[model samples]
Target chain A: MSAFVSISLVYLAIYTLSAWSLNLQYGYAGIINFGWIVFQSIGAYVAATTALGSPTSGGFQTYIFGARLGFPLPLIMGTLAGAALALLLGLIILTRRIRPDFQAIIMLVVAIIAAEVVSTNTALFNGANGLSNVPQPFNGVMHLSYNNYQWFFVAFSFALCIIVYFGLEWICRSSWGRALRAMREDDILASHVGINVQALRIVVFVIGGAIAGFSGALLVEFLGTWSPDAWSFVESFVVFVSVYVGGRANNRGAIIGAFLVPVVFGTMPSFLPEFGYPGLSANLEWLVIAALWLTTFYLRPAGILPEGRFIARRTRAREQAPVMPPIAKQGSVA
Target chain B: MNLYIEAIGFGVIAASSIALGAMGFTLQFGLTNVLNVGYGATMSFGAIVAYAAHLTGMSIWLALICGGIATSGLTLLSAKTLLRVYAKRGAALFEMAMVTFGIALIVEYAIASITENNTFSLTIAIEHTHALGPIRFTDVQLALVILAVVVFILLDGFLRLTKVGTALRATAVDPDLARASGIATGRIVTIAWLLSGFLCGLAGGVFTIDILTVNAFTGDSLLSLVIVAALMGTAGSVRGAALAALLLGIATQLVSAAGASGYASAVAYGVLAVVLLARPKSVQGGLVADRVQITV
Candidate 1:
């Protein structure tokens, strides 16, 4: 029970980090990244490859980049891998004259095709079997017990989550964040207002992709395994449902969503007693998710914790303006 | 050379199935203006329904018919019930696609739950093989090719010759104008649904038989390939879609035959990505975002 609690906390933190990234993209930027899982998978694969120290053809496992550059480095490389992919895909997808639906289709196709390619190419990323026995962070130096290590990792992940949460908050309140929202709401109007819609889109897409990568890197370090099976196109959709349920443009909403969806609902079915068959609960989990997604769309499209209305600072200080603000503001305005 | 020829034969057969689905998709998309991502799910559902019918002692041909009808009904039902409901609420094109994905998940997993998530094998006895020059094929493959040709011809004739087809064409071009011209665009839309659904169902049945397997995820898997074909062909052009299917089918098969079977799907997607990136304007129709919603 304690072990499970520790693992769940780690996953919760990881998922929150992911949700924050996705919120930045879909919630604020209005880019529906249907291929979001691929970014995470990229992070995991790169981290595994970099840390596993290359493949022994006549040995146990095979992968590229055999240099096992201990902790933090692998994680950094993973983040860079993610950013690289995002940069490429964003250029292909965002620097174009296309509809949002078309963008979604393109991303969806990319995700599906990517899975097929990764699974088929046996030499690259060990095909579908995936790379396992990944080195844990500071496993060599830390002489901690297994469960204690788990707790430490959980704390480490949560710390990263707090950092990411603040980062997303900073982006959300930034002028650039306002630009993203403006473009999302009305691209035409945003353009009219002199916002570089395409460039802004690419920037946010890369940022979100980086965050997704970082989250995946953190996740794999704790779990010590990475595989194609871990992330599917459906996994991408599931995250989208999380953001939708939690609320799009809000970091607090992302935390709430990540915890509620993956941490609570996703984990709940596993703990339930056997019902009809072995895979019944697994299938039911997806079915229930779809139902929840549809219900959210119908009942509360803004999700449980909708984006809070922005309050301008000037308007916020107007309550004390009865004596000093009118003349000072008028003088400044003049 | 013989291997190349054999791959071409298989490619043509595969193209027949893909073309059938693409045609139906083009018709629905062009007329209704909704890119129904659930089309693939519906296709799989139809195939499964047909397979069940076959197990229950229906002839293969009869099962095919049953599957087609069931799929059509299901497609119409979804369009009328779910899609229409969402569209009425001012859901944009992208939002509608997302909604259809939700429907697809339910439909696919429902089948998965029923079938116990096991992949069912489908084997129909292959009749005598015939050879002409470097090409060889079973009677069933020849028959499938013929079926595709016949479907296209009949559909072309109906759309070109019939008054209702004219209304469909007109409605596809502009629904409001058709209504102004006193054509009951609503009834035409119902007919369009039936026709497109039938083709979609037929395509599903054909695809399952060609692949010789059926599973809940099969339709979803085939969705991207079918979309690649449908989109490559102009949005509503049947001939264009059929041609695109042939191109994709042949390209993937030839590449697979060249000893890289796994990258074959990727190769096809690579082509789609390139074409889409090159010709973004073709998909958008115009900058105005004009789309005619189907009442049926």
Candidate 2:
């Protein structure tokens, strides 16, 4: 029970990080990244390969490249991998002024193709079986009991989450975050106002991708496995749903959403007694998630905790400053 | 050379299935302005329904019709009820797409749970094999090709000749204007949904026949190709969709024949990506925010 509690805490932290990253991209920036899971999966694969060292010729798993990197280095490389991929995709997707829906479909297609490529190219990530036996960070040096280590990892993950949460809060409340909202509402107008919409979009995309990568690395280090099944395209939707349910453009909502959706509702089924066939519960879980998504959209489009209006101090001062603007309007009307 | 020819032959068969689905997708998307990602799930549902009909001792052809009709009703009902609810609630184009995706998940998992997550093999006895030059096709494949051609002709005729078809075209172009011109836009949209849904279902049946397998995810797996074909073609242009489908079908088969069967679909998607990158104006014009109102 303690192990379960620790693992659930870790998952909650990881999912919260993912939801925050996605909220940064879609909720704030208005970039509908339908292929969000690919970024996370890429991060996991990179971290696993880097930490797993070299693969033997007839070993249990085969990957494209391997290295015996130290703990921090693998995580850093994973983050970089995600950022680089986001850069590549952003250049392709955001460089042009395609319709938002078209951009989304492209991202979805990319996710699907990436999954297919990774699963089919056995040399890349050991085919559908995926890369397993990923080395845990600090496992050998700590010499702690397994349960104690789990708690340690959970604490480590939650610490990172707090850091990310505050970092995202700082960013979202900045002038640049306001620029993202402007772009999301109207890019043409935002560009007219000299916001450099394209550049801002790419930058935000990279940042979100890095965060997603970091979360993926942390999760893989704890679980010690990464597979295609773990990060399917549908998983991206799960995060999207979390962001939607939690409240778009609100970091606290993202955390709440991650806890409620992926952490609570996602794990609730496992605790129930097995009544139906083996896979029925899993399918039913997905069905309920999808239904909940629709219900959220219908009942609470603004989410449980909608984004609060952010009135800057200067704006408030300007609004409060005495209304002396009727002179020209009265003259014009006369 | 023979290998390439054989690939081309197989490409024709694949194109028939793709064209059917792409045509329906493009037509409805152009008219309704909803991406309808649930389309693939609806196709899967239709195929499963057809399989069930076949199990009930119905002829395969009749079963296909049943599947098409069932999907048509489902599509119409969803459009009239579920989609309309979202649209009325002010969901934009992207949000509507997300809604459809949610619907897709519900339907897909429902099917998965009912089927026990098992893939069912579809068996239809092939009477004979027909050879054309270096290409060989079974009877079923030949029938599918003929079915595609016949549907295309009928659809083309309907779109070109009928007044309702003209209304559909007009509504697709401008809904308010079509209404101003005394066309009942609502009825036309209903027709669009039903017709497109039927085509989508038929495509699923033909695809199942080609692959000889049925599963909850089968249509979704084929959806990328369908979307590729639909986007490659001009929206609402049946001929363009058919031509694009043919092109993609041949490209995928040739790529597979070149020994990288796994990346065949990727190659087709690459073409779309390149098209999108090179000529965004031709494929998807500059961002028109809120210009496309969901018409469901």
Candidate 3:
């Protein structure tokens, strides 16, 4: 039970990080990154390959870019790889004024094709079987027992999660974050008001990609394996559901959604007694997730905790007059 | 040379299936402005229904019709009921796509649970092999090609000659104006859903017959190619979709023949990217209205 709790805590951190990244991208910047899983998968593969040591010719598993990197280096490389990939994709997809729906479809296609490419190119990442036996960070140096190591890892993960949570909060509260919200609301208006929409999109995309990559690295280090099956296009939908359910543009809502959707609803089913066929529970879990997604969209489109209005601090003159708030409210009403 | 020729033959067969699906997809999207990502799931459901009908001792052709009918009803029902709910709730264009995706997940996973996640092999007996020049096709393949051609002719005629088809075209261009012109836009939208759904189901049946396998994911796996074909063409132009489908089908087969079978779909998508990059205006122009209103 303790081991399960440790693992669940680690997953909670990872999912929370992913949801926050997606919230930054879709919820704030209005960039619908339907290919979000590809960024995460690239991070995991990079981290696993870098830490797994050199591959031998005709070995049990073959993968490119194999090296024995130190713990922090692998994680850093993973994050960098994610940002680089996001830069490349964002340059191609975001430079133009494509319709948002069309852009999303292109992303979805990219994700599906990426999976196919990875699975078929065995020499790249050992094909469908995927790369396993990834070395754990600090396992040898600490000389701790397995359970103790799990708890240590859990603490480390939580520490990172807290750091990311606060970092994102700072970013979301900053002027740049305000620009992202403006872009989400209306990119044309944001641009007219001096926001470099294209550059802003690419930058936010890279930041979100870096976060996704960092989470993937952390997950791969703990799990000690990375596979194509783990990062299917549908996996991105899981994170999207989290952001939508939690509440867009709200960091607290992202945390709540990460906990409720991926951690509670996504993982809790496996703990139940096996009743039907082997994979029935898994299928049913997806059904429930989909149903939950639709229900959330229908009942509370603004989510359980809608984004609060950001009213500017009142100046002395404004406070004395007290005239602008009603006008603003009337404009919104009209 | 012979390898390329044989690939062309295979491409033609593949194009038939793709064209069927793409035409239906483009038609629905043009008229309704919903991306309908659940289209693939509906196709899978249709194929499953056809397989069940075949099990009940019906002829394969009749089973295919049953599949088409089932999907048509499903698509119409969802459009009238489920999609209507979301649109009325003020879901934006992209949100509607997400809604369809959720619907897809529900239908796909429900089917997966019921089917026990098994890939059922379809035993379609090929009675004869016909050779035209260097390319040989089984009886089923020949029939598929003929079916595609007949459907294309019929659809083109319907859209060009008929008054209702003109109304659909007009409404697709401007729904508000069509309504002002005394066209019952609601009825036209309903017909669009029913017709497109039938075509989508037929495409699924033909795709299953061609592949000779049935699974929940099969239709979805083919959806990317369908989408590419649909997008490569103009939104509402059947001719453009047919041309694009042919191009993609031939390109995919040619790539596969060049020894990288896995990268064939990627190559097809690459073509779309190039088109998008080169002629951004032509592909996306006039398709997206300044204000996108869901015409359910």
Docking class of 2: medium
What is the C-alpha local distance difference test score of candidate 3? 0.89
True-structure lDDT of candidate 1? 0.84
Candidate 1 per-residue lDDT, tens place, A106-188, comes to 88879988898888887788888888899898878989999999998988888877787777877788777788888888877
Model 2 chain A: which ten-residue window has the lowest total lDDT? A325-334
True contacts kept of each: 0.46, 0.65, 0.48
Off by over 4 Å in 3: A312-334, B282-290
lDDT of 3 by residue, A1-334 (tens): 8887888888899999999889999988888899999999899999999999999887889999899999899999899999999999999888877766777787888888889889999999999999999999999799999899999999999999889989998888778888988888877788899999889999999999999999999999999998899999999999999999999988889888898888888987787789888999999999999999999989989877778775434544566785656555555756
Task: Flag regions of model 1 displaced more than 4 Å.
Answer: A318-320, A323-334, B285-296
lDDT of 1 by residue, B1-296 (tens): 88888888889998988898999988888888788888888999988988999999998878988988999999999888888887887777766887888888889888889888899998889869999777887888888899999999999889889998888999988888899999998898888888888888888888888888998877765677788888888777888899999988888899989999888888888888777878876765321133435344
Candidate 2 segments exceeding 4 Å error:
A316-334, B282-288
Residue-level lDDT tens digits of model 2 in B188-211: 999999999999889888899889
Q: What share of the true interface contacts does candidate 2 keep?
A: 0.65
- How well is each residue in B140-199 modelled by candidate 3, as lDDT tens digits? 999999999999999989999999999999999999999999999999999999988888
Comparing 1 with 2 on TM-score, the higher-scoring candidate is 2
Clashing pairs in 3: none
